[model samples]
Target: MSAAARETPRWLAPAPLWTARTVAAASEEFLRPWIAELRTDSFLADFLSIVGGTDGRSPADLPATLPERSDEDGSYRLFPSHSRRYYLVLASLVCHRPGIPDHTVQPALGERALFVLRRIRQGAEKGFVPSATDTGTWQPATAHALVPGERELPLHRAPVAAFAAPGTAAATLGMAAGQPSARTVRYGYIPVSGGDTVADDVTTTYVIRAVLVRDPCAPVISAPTQPFELAGPLDPDAPRRPSAATTKGPTS
Candidate 1:
């Protein structure tokens, strides 16, 4: 056996019969620092644009941009383009897994996935609601409260038809909820070389956390169950609020 493999505990070695799960104790440990360093509209715009491109959309069609300030309720209002929402959902889903070497899907990231998943679910539910104006543009809004029930969907059972080719085995991903009974499915993709020996294999997994219900009548603001934290090139004590003297619009 290879030295590295021998060094690993027998239980820690990858097994054909086991699916390992990764969990983030706090999602904000990564999110807050990233958000705090976004001190300008240009940064926000560019970030959202990159996020949108991941979903196959032109950034020009995104919604009206917002200032780089978190609202009084501590939520950052990012007006990503209509097409960008899908990317945001996917990005949010994966962000908590910072240093994973490749995109190997696991059952779920546990509590770390909760923060981003909650935000994505809220955005998706809002997208389904009727528009308040006839302008045909969807309103970019945020809810302060956790929408009543969790919006959980089984990862493998949820229809990813929009993202995958017809009849492909994309459904074999992972469970959708955080409960102990959750099950995981793995779908592997292999690339064949001239000799047909497997050149590469990639797998993606998903887990449904919960199915959230919309509560339009609920209060718009509430205390966070957990506060956001900072990581990577950002100082936690740095002023989160932008300088008052800074003017709006692009600054050279």
Candidate 2:
């Protein structure tokens, strides 16, 4: 084997096949330090204050915009932390998703708006489902992409009903901070709202993460259950130190 390859740490497996809870606990343990930092960091506290009360999606853009605590730099290669790329997993929480075209299928616009308003008022008191509006396009709003009176569906009266969810803290690329980042969103459906469309039923569409699925916010049905992570950048010329047992010199 090449010197570098020989030096690589021999990977080990957790006591054969581990249980699901074992996995979750392992992941929780691994990320404990980072999560603690987030809980106490003044920067995060201020950012949470900015994010908490607002009617934003759970772990939404607010999390995306939070400044990365790691020193961000562009020059390092083989280092994932250089730009502090991140992924997040969040569970169902009271949320407001911006409505879009699919929600505007009904012919009579007025009726559409009315139905959503009624739903909001009648929805469970625990969560506030906003009344859907005729215009919910924020991306296009600033660009003046749509003409007046030509109202497209906007997200207004949406509520997340899913119960307890797991949370995972992952890194994020500084995309919002003028750094390059990739974001992908995947829609999830419940038994009530999947498959071929039927008229008159509320089509529940939610992000798998209970928020936007982007580089900053990711969904995790299963997280690592063992002590594992990507290997740090390996140096080709570095010497490999012997293991603890081998390194101990003979007692004189």
Candidate 3:
């Protein structure tokens, strides 16, 4: 195995479990139906607020705010106060696809990562969440370390908080607020390597974070099996293994 392959972390198994095409197809199908069921503006607002850790409200407390439709495009988009970052992340993760160009997924992944970081920071500011360490305090060190020159991107404002967990650092971005009180978020990175000598062949280590929110009755969102079928075949030797995808239904 190559050096990069050897360094592959155990947490990033989900990214490679199914190919990018599979992820994208599953996302479009599974998520479109789920979002359509919401059908209310406040439903999305509360969902975004809860996910973003703004007021530390649960999905149950969300008012009846629905997304406005674009007269020109006829697509549903979140309200302005809603974080475009979180929406994109949820969309990407729930809809990942295999064999698609990295250029497409990269932007969504980066945006999601930044969204989590911002949420953690916001939680810290509101005293809803604590930084990574157990000292029960926030520190600059808890922030994510950007790859040198990549800091200039508007989405790069927040730093990623690393922890020993199952998902990528990006997944845990906004989960800090619910830590100890409502949820525990874990963050890490997955490095994909192989193929070419140039940067083109270098698969990025996607930063992913998973939020374990407190919901005894939360509905489980099923991971579609179609993605696996679409992606050629899973590498038997791949380090981290992918499991069925499940979402902790509306937080309440």
Candidates by lDDT, descending order: 3, 1, 2
Instruction: Report the C-alpha lDDT of model 2 over 1-252, residue by residue, as the tens digit.
Output: 232322111101111111234333543422211010122224333333422323333323232322122222211111122222222221211112221111221223212111010011112111122236742321211111122222222212222111112221111211121322222211121111112222445432211111111122221111211111222333333433222211111111
Alpha-carbon shift of residue 56 in model 1 (angstroms): 14
Q: Against the true structure, what is each candidate's TM-score?
A: 0.21, 0.15, 0.22
Could you give the candidate ranking by TM-score, starting with the highest?
A: 3, 1, 2
| Residue 18, candidate 2: C-alpha displacement in angstroms | 34
lDDT of 3 by residue, 21-134 (tens): 333354433222112113223544544454344555542222222223333333332222122211222222222233221211133222232222111222231111343555
* Cα lDDT for residue 174, candidate 3: 25
Which parts of model 2 have CA positions greater than 4 angstroms off? 1-40, 53-60, 63-89, 93-252
Q: Tell me the whole-model lDDT of each prediction, alpha carbons only.
A: 0.22, 0.20, 0.24
**Candidate number of the best TM-score:** 3
Model 3 CA deviation exceeding 4 Å by range: 1-49, 52-56, 60-66, 76-252
RMSD of each: 21.2, 24.4, 20.6
Q: Write the per-residue lDDT of candidate 1 for residues 1-252, one digit (tens) a residue.
A: 332322110000001111112122222221221111223435434434432333453212222222233334333333232212101211112211322211222223211112212222222422122334642322323444343333322211111111222222211122112212122211111111112122344211111122112222222121121121111132323443443222121110
Write the number of the candidate with greater lDDT, choosing between 1 and 2: 1
Q: What TM-score, to 2 decimals, does candidate 3 have? A: 0.22
